[model samples]
Target: MTYSTENTLLYVEDLSVSYGDKTVIKDINFVEKDVIRTGNVTGQVIAFVGRSGRGKSTLFRALTGLVKPSSGKVLIADTTTGIDNDAKVVNEGDIGFVDQKYTLFRNKTVSQALMFALRNKEITKEEKEVKIKEYLHQWGLEKVKDQYPNELSGGQRQRTAIIEQIFCSGHYMVLDEPFSGLDVGNIQDVKDAFNLMTASHEFNTIIYSTHDIELAVELADSIYVIGYPSIEGKLADYGTIVKHIDMKEIGLAWKDFGLDHMEVVKQIKAAMLSS
Candidate 1:
């Protein structure tokens, strides 16, 4: 599975976040490029795995610009300009974030919520309606288009939240513990939503965090482990990226899960435990 990369889709350098006197995460860095594969549309699915109390949630907040970092910066491709390495500092609204709760408008029906997501777009009302319809159909939410958030199932609500982000934002999405609390069937539904998003565009990137190491290995092409680092033979209090694994480089990406994946899962679990 040979693939080439184009422009940098996401870039982070020396990023650190602190709250008051406590430094949560520090010295975080990573880069993800727009993957180009022959005869296939490739999108990035990056996962972060670590023990609880690690800074995964804080990192996600900074990535989505919900919280400001105390140091360093995050940059994503300037889609407003062009795809020619024109980078811009990430700000609020630059990326969409979907949390575990899958929050939605209680009063708005699925169709209405989707339409509201497109309110800032330059397209006309008819065009927006068409786009919403397409997404609802594609995500298998067409039958529930008229349903409100309270009326939908957990999976349906999650899918609607995901689609809302897609329409409101663009290619970049950050999901914080998306698989949390989901049953097996609902988990598959969310997985299907991930596939649909990636298949729809080449630059569509999904960055997520999970405790399930096997699922991280199975779904993500790239995985990062965040944990407290040791310095001078003593463990530090701050969390940072301790390890990164490229599934593509190891011939595990986009392949069926097997013994190889299980081994990687074990490795990740060990990393989490030690850190």
Candidate 2:
């Protein structure tokens, strides 16, 4: 598959996060551009994989503007400005974040929760209702539209959480350990949700972290391995990006999982173990 990049969709430069005296992530930098493919809408799925305590969560928090970076900036396409070259520093609520727990409003039904997510939209109530209904149907949550979070299954709740984010934020979304603690069936459900997002919008970018190397290789078009950097033959204390694998460049992205993908998985595992 051949594709070309247009305007920048996301840019992170010299991003570092610190908690008081401790620096968690340092000198992290990456950029993702709008992937243009003829006769197809191609969104980006970027994955971060590393050993535990490698600051993946901290990186995600900064990306979503939950936590401010001590140095550098995160920038995204400025859709609000309507200028193609305009970009904005990411702010809180600019990007939706869905943690592993799939948190939701306990008191709100699936339909009501979706309505709340659209509160800031300029659309009328009737329009919002129509949109919510459309999303519920499309996400396979129509049957549970009136049910509260407590009454829904894990997959249903996860879908609701994701849809809420899509309605609240714009194209950028950060999911921390989304596939963790999920069964095979539930994992498939999440993967389907990812497909739904990417298919719906060309600039819809999903940034996620996971320990599952094979799943990351299978789902992400670009993969970043975050780990301790080596200096003078010794590992540094601060975590940073050690290796970046572009599945698209390697002819592994958007393809069925096979020996090639397994090979990439092994490469990722080796990077993780050494760092």
Candidate 3:
């Protein structure tokens, strides 16, 4: 659960992403979420939390190659490609991203949809079946795997979408607002899916974005807060970031990973103080 001594798995430094001339975010570092501006992201669960227009989705797009950043680079390992359009740095299966809204083939059954994702992976039929069953059980999608998207409830749809992403065997996974449309039971399922993926597989990193700060605290190992600077209150907004750090320095770390790491909390507090 800890990686105090390991190689850098993913690194993003001085990442400045913008939409045209309008700068949405600058000097944004997604290393360990808010804890650092530029560092290594490995074996880290980073939750990007902010207001509606703080560019959380924008950050996700840039990381996944859906949106090109005006500047900066995302260095990924393994097979997930498109980290750099100009030069190859990583493969195409190392990173997986879950869209904020549910996106599935309404016409295709759950099994069909998952099979579509596995088409190019070169996995054996038995291996694929095993993986599908494992994910279905892990996400509680066993009964509904034979149903279509429209036939399932909102939570079930979300689970299907998440399972599809997790089965990609990516080291880094990004889920945008993954808890938005889920009931209590499904929320627990999604949380369990995360735990199992990180524990059983070497799926080390996850970057989940949400407006729910409380949920982020519960699910994230590191938190990233992005507040947009308005026309008249840029200085004050910067001050708020400072205040956030000050508050966290007084021992406000999230405890969902378990209450056993009291020393981890102290270390996080110390790191915040030094920063």
TM-score of 1: 0.98
lDDT string, candidate 2, 33-90, tens digits: 8887789888999999999999999999999999999999999999878889589999
lDDT of 3 by residue, 194-224 (tens): 7765564343777787755556666665565
lDDT of all predictions: 0.92, 0.92, 0.62
> Over 4 Å off in model 1, which ranges?
none
- Model 2 lDDT, residue 154, Cα: 82
Could you give candidate 1's per-residue lDDT for residues 182-239 as a string of tens digits?
8999999999988988888998999999988888999999999999998888889999
- The clash count of every prediction, one per candidate, is 0, 0, 9
lDDT of 3: 0.62
TM-score of 3: 0.75
Error of 2 at 184 (Å): 1.4
